[model samples]
Target: MNPNLLTPPRRHGERPTTTGLEIPHDQLDMFSPPRVRAELVKQAQALPGVFTGPSQVSEPSSLALRLRQPLGPWEAFLHPSTDEFGHIHRAGFLHLTLPRPLLAPLVEAGWAEQHPISLRPEWPDTIVMLYAPRDDGELDVVLAALRASWQQASTEKGR
Candidate 1:
């Protein structure tokens, strides 16, 4: 894996609004606001094998990314609610390929939930969706989890 994959103090992408984001307004909460969502998208885009576009968004407003290393779809967006054909997913959330050993602890800690490998058959192991952070403290925790997930994906690919 690249040692300098994602470092802090980096620039993020465009700010997500209630109109162009993939997630709907009802889904937004203090846990995951537009600012936080934008930050998450910015960070994810900083990693390798990530792309943002109409391929992930049905509309021009949707802010989402398609990752290749782990090979999955993720969104760090809100607003412009998700339509039936949209591939953009929840903001501040992640679906990752995690080992069963790791999954159990995350679930017990209320940090994650099993998302079923059926959603992404190409993945080698079971995946989980880490929830959006509820506050700054939770954002830190969520970022750590996301980093770990990205590491796992990179390691699996022998990057």
Candidate 2:
């Protein structure tokens, strides 16, 4: 994929506040309302090669997005214990894997940040916590990021 294509425009306003290293990592502001959050889950589950399930690495209430047939590198997963490419928190933020090239750009653009666990040597640095979509426009961008993750998981590309 073209790096430019994955580079979304800088998100407007300041980055939403988050509980950076907390176990229940969460975005405290710029929330995706219940309706938008539901829609995001609905649309993300509809993405090709994906299915919704209880997260293998998150709270039981969190929704995990898994690839039915993964062909990409291990970096496509939030953890090696599962094929999950992403999972939406009850608070609406998401933890997903992105291609290495897309990582810094997304973070710099203020759409996401590296997952706290990702700082560990055992974890893939590709893991990131995508901020919640506060509205339709942001939802589109979040979905695009999810699609990028789906594409990465459905291909054989290396990190």
**What TM-score goes with each of the models?**
0.52, 0.90
For model 2, residues 1-159, the per-residue Cα lDDT tens digits are: 222535678888999898898766777888889999999999898888888889999887899998888788877887864579999988789999998888888899899988889888998889899999888878888888888888998887654
Off by over 4 Å in 1: 1-31, 54-91, 117-125, 156-159
Model 2: CA > 4 A from native? 1-6, 157-159
- Model 2, residue 88: C-alpha shift (Å): 0.6
lDDT of each: 0.45, 0.85
Q: Give the top-scoring candidate (TM-score).
A: 2
Give candidate 2's TM-score: 0.90
